[model samples]
Target chain A: MEKTNIRTNKNFNKVSDIIESLTINTNPDSVAVLEEIGTNSSIDEVRELTSRALVKRNEHDSLQVVISNRGKGINDMSTIVAMSTINELLSLENKEEAMRVLENTISSEGFDEEVKENARSVKALMALS
Target chain B: MSAIEKVNQLSHRIFNTSKNEQSTSRTSNPFAASNFQKNILTEDVFESSKSKEANKVNFTGNLSASSKRIYSVFVGSINDIGSRISSGIESIKAFGSRMKEGIVNTCVNTWNKIHEIGNKEESLNGTKELLGRDITTFFVNKREREISKMANMNPHMEVKSIFKDALQALEADMVQVA
Candidate 1:
């Protein structure tokens, strides 16, 4: 494993920047950046930034945008990010709607079978909830 | 006998007798040419009977009931086997593709998680001094809304316990950092 150093102030500034961007305007690029930091950075603050951004995004964007972004296929990082964000938010509540999205993912011809199976697992998890 | 009446009787006998003679003998017309009568008979049997025999063979009504049933079952089984083989191959292909996808995603997720943790561990190295109050402030602010939502909106005990565990981890982090 390759270890990389990120200064504490730099991490704080990046998190602040992400929070600022998420609060002010959430374009695809901003969403992309937050997701990158969340998945790549070792800092919990950065992941929290991503979590917060997703919450903000869920509030600002339409469900169609979330679903469309998710259905763009799983090969892209953005799609994974969108999926994780949607999954997190939908898991909080909205069981029926989440199940609907999971079903669409499972049944749609475009998604990878593994991704569909992952969605199935998520659906099963939701059922427990 | 009158001359015209005898000629007419001779003409009827020759024409009628010639057709019957053509069936019985190869040389039916002794003087009028045997090949012409043979040609006519060949055409009548070959062209007419050929079509009649073909028609009879084509109609299933000519076949026995048991033979017809056997033929029907044979054709039906061939169709059934063809469809079953095709569907079986399709499902196998689908299963193979799914296995490939699962392996790929598993590798990808593992790689991402490992890299992220490695990077975090690297950053945290020698940072035991800077973490206390700063980390406390971060988790406290970040989790407040989430914890409140889980406590209020959702009534499930499992969900509450999960949130409580997460909150406990944050508090543990806060204690370590502070």
Candidate 2:
């Protein structure tokens, strides 16, 4: 039991550190790393945390990673995680930046329809609020 | 139809899924998005429940004749539910692409489709609804329900309050832009 508890705590701290660095680290490659690993993790909890961290950073680059990626961020396979990400996006203090990213995602012809449709959902919710 | 096939048929109706048809990609038909759901996502509800055997009900107590008949009917229905579910699970697994995110995506598509059809009110006349609530208003109410569910699952998250504010802000007057 003690071993399991320590292992769990260590994992939790590791995830927290990742999220903290993703938000505070100003390097462009930092966000790139987050997009590649954090969002792409098969675990729903990891993907959800990455999404929240990106939304919390409130930057165009971070927001674009979550909004445009397939099977990640708002496009998560788990409803709870996806909804959680959407909730975080809506809770941002400066909603305009997220709105800008979502708008571009919607109008861009490059994205898959699934991505665009998901973006459209976020836009509708954002528009309402 | 075979009993399993019958059960599969009933499962299709219960899950609101296409019968034996692989769900077309959202790109093919924008409206086919909400195709995945809860039962499809689970690993094996029947097998898990069977192994544990915790959910089995005991109806062995002495009872009057009429009461026993009612109990028999209840037991039959419960057994039917279990069988129908097992068959449905198999059929859904056959459909492939059992992504949980598809559940939310499908909801968005259907919700948007209703509003889109309501806006036209021409060529199709699909705006007709039963309860006198406009399509947009109906959609808001549904989202409100969803927000409540999400909130319960993750009370730490702000999912519920954000959606509540969105619904209240719209006041059901705002139609979703398709």
Can you write out model 2's per-residue Cα lDDT over B119-166, one digit (the tens) per residue? 777534443553345767887676556434442442223332332343
Candidate that would win on lDDT:
2
Per-residue CA lDDT of candidate 1, range A9-115, in tens? Answer: 43344334434444344234444433433434333444444554544454433221333333322212454454555456445654555567667777889866766
lDDT of 2 by residue, A1-129 (tens): 232342344344345444554465554555665676567654455577778888888889989988988877798888877898999998987899999999999999999999999999999998888
Segments of candidate 2 deviating more than 4 angstroms: A1-8, B1-178
Docking class of 2: incorrect
Model 1, runs deviating above 4 Å: A1-9, A16-52, A55-91, B1-178
Query: How do the residues B88-113 of candidate 1 rate in per-residue lDDT, one tens digit apiece?
Result: 99899899889988998899899989
Note each model's CA RMSD in angstroms.
Answer: 31.6, 48.7
How accurate locally is residue B141 in candidate 1, as Cα lDDT from 0 to 100? 72
Clashing pairs in 2: A77-B101, B33-B106, B34-B106
